[model samples]
Target: MSRSQRKQEDPDLGVLSSRTLFSLQRELFTKLGEQGHPDLRPRHGAVLAYLDVAGSRATDLATQSGQHKQVIGTLVDELVALGYVERQPDPADRRAKLIVPTEKGLDHMAKSDAILAEMEAEHAKAVGEEAYAEFKRVFRLVAARQAGS
Candidate 1:
């Protein structure tokens, strides 16, 4: 579907707009910064979100984030330095290190989730219940396709 048509049909779907996504991301990062987490950029936040779902090796993160392995390695280093994550010896593969969120990371995620939940509530209020539900369903389907690619 055309981007404009989608936006008009459901304002919440406008979140797919790069400008809108960036703005929302910046707002969330600002909120994180205010919470005393200064270096939590969107990329770093994505890494945290991924790790939150399950601990994974660096290679796994690279694949899931669609980022180069080298780039994800650099980010992982930064996250380790910031104490938001730690590398643990992967039991399944001793040579590979699994990235896991620290306690502080989990706490930060809780706060971040609260902010995101508020944003979602605003989106639902704007788009109505039915459209909001469809938006989530379709968005997930699209995301799965993109991830597979």
Candidate 2:
């Protein structure tokens, strides 16, 4: 059976979550593109979403993003080539490298944060503020549980 048919037959939590995630990603990337970071793609979020302005090690990013170290390394390389990030010496561990955001990356991060806030506000408005807050709370709990699993 086709994917749509399967969804229609059983609209489970997994299906709903996947659909919501994809929709959110589409809206987010489209807005980001309009804001001048058109080069970013959904896959890039693996690194960008978990990245810290102060810089982080690839292993940290991998853990935060729930991706493999090798995958994180590849994403970091892409981000570096795109001028979003660079490798710098870790102050604490001179031999280890930190993934530091460049000026362009900082700008992108700021823009993304603003966009996400706007989106959240819109959602809250759509579903009553209290209801939205509760929804987010439940989502976080469920996500944490699933991560452990």
Candidate 3:
């Protein structure tokens, strides 16, 4: 956007980060869904990112996602219905169930990784590789700090 247009829209610069990120995320996921992952949703991204390919449990997902069991359960239910995950009896604790990723889930993860790499390249080109790398470094540091807190 032109400088005057940006200033007119947001003199405080309050909505820039979150609004742009949300818009970029939405566009990326929407295009991805059109490509092949039609069942995925924006809300599913967090829990899905935390999931291990080997296996886990609803409680584990909840812990990793920093969300409640009920919330993770809802996401798991959607994922299960969409054939991305399957629940099987946990061998260690027969009373508990293990949430395992289906082949389709792994496939989607791989595709999403590639798409993110492409996005990184685009960012690098826009701001130069050194700036982009520093940006990512700072982002990771902030995320790690927030995660610790």
| Per-residue error (Å), model 1, residue 118 | 1.7
Provide TM-scores for the models: 0.81, 0.93, 0.80
lDDT of 3: 0.82
Q: Please give the lDDT score at residue 37 for candidate 2.
A: 93
lDDT of 3 by residue, 9-50 (tens): 766424555676687678778777977898798788756777
Model 2 lDDT tens row, 12-108: 8898899888998999999999999999999999999989999999999999998999999999999999999999999999999999999999999
What CA root-mean-square deviation does each model show from the true structure?
A: 4.2, 1.9, 3.9
1 against 3, candidate with superior TM-score: 1
lDDT of each: 0.81, 0.94, 0.82
Superposition TM-score, candidate 2 onto the true structure: 0.93
lDDT of 1 at 75: 92
Q: Show the colliding residue pairs in model 2.
A: none
Q: Pick the candidate with the highest TM-score.
A: 2
**Which model scores highest in lDDT?**
2
Show pairs that collide, candidate 3: none
Model 1, runs deviating above 4 Å: 1-16
Candidate 2 Cα errors over 4 Å, as ranges = 1-6
